[model samples]
Target: MKFKVVEKFTSINGEGPLAGQLVVFIRFAGCNLNCSYCDTKWANKDNVCYDFMTSNDIYKYIKSTEIRNVTLTGGEPLLQEGIIELLELLSKDRSLHVEIETNGSIPLNEFGHIENPPSFTMDYKLPCSNMEDKMDLNNFHGLSPRDTVKFVCGTMEDVQKSKLIIDTYELSDKTNVYISPVFGQIDLEKIVGFMVYNKMNGINLQIQLHKIIWDQNKRGV
Candidate 1:
């Protein structure tokens, strides 16, 4: 089976708990949701040019690299066909730490069947994203403690909603929780203050480390 791979490169883990770590990023093409601040709109367009490669081919390329941590990112990696096999192939590497970045809508049960299931970096879109209703909160219950649940907030309302989601899902206790600002908007100081005021010691405030290192709009590191 083959995948429509947008691009693959080595870059610092820009978000989540893995931020600042060097890792190989495999960004797959296509996404089901359209967020207001989506950085990779090119990935969502079906007409965009892409390299079609099989999972084995990808694994071989990664095997050649010195880095063992691989982030299977998207345009919603879950939406791509034959993705399970791709993930399965990549996970076969005992030294590799496979992380899947997904918009929380997709079902994760299929990953459970995988012998070496990848840790999920699940994003719960907030009100400002206009895709909050698309989230499947029920899916959070199935995630293991090793997975990370992130919320990208652009406004104070989004921050409020993030807190509610954590409480409702008991996310901080279940998995690693992160609340990141939307690039330019929603300054870190404001979000940090909100978190501190609310006694949210368990949750973390994160930013796009890659954007800070490179340009915010730059793709492929």
Candidate 2:
């Protein structure tokens, strides 16, 4: 089966635990949700131009890079028709570390059990995104420490909601939890103060390093 790939490039991961580290990014086309602060909205369009490549084609391109880190991103990589096949192919290479930057709406149960499954940087859409209701809470049931649950805060309410979800699910102990602001929308000092007041010990505050290193709107990074 052919996957609709929007672009492929080598760059430093801008978010998650792998931030600032070199990684091969294979961005697929299309998505199931649209968030207000989405930076990659161009790639999510149904009419977006893309290359029809088989799983092997993607694997070959990744191997050619000789980079150990491979990030299967989107539009929503999991939304691709044959993503599990692609993941399985990549897993055959023991040297490569794979991660999927997925929107939290999709269920992770099947993906989590795949052979040599890729690490997940799952987003837990907060109140501001207007997509929080779409999140699949069941996804949290199978997350390991290798996985991450990110909350993109755009307001004080988002921050408070993130804390509630973190505590309710005991996410800090189950998986890595991060609180990232919506770029220019939220104040870092307020987030820090809230964290301090609540003593949010295990959660992290992540910034998009790529956006800082390069133009925030520039693609193919």
Best by lDDT: 2
For residues 34-121, could you state the per-residue lDDT of candidate 2 as single tens digits? 9999999999997999999998999999989999999999999999997888888888898999999999998888875667889999
Off by over 4 Å in 1: none
- Minimal lDDT window, size 10, model 1: 85-94
For model 2, the stretches where C-alpha displacement exceeds 4 angstroms are: none
Clashing pairs in 1: none
lDDT of each residue in 48-114, candidate 1, tens digit only: 8889889898898888878988998889999888888888787777899989999998988777988
Instruction: Give each model's whole-structure lDDT.
Output: 0.88, 0.92
Cα-lDDT of candidate 1: 0.88
Report the number of the highest-TM-score candidate: 2
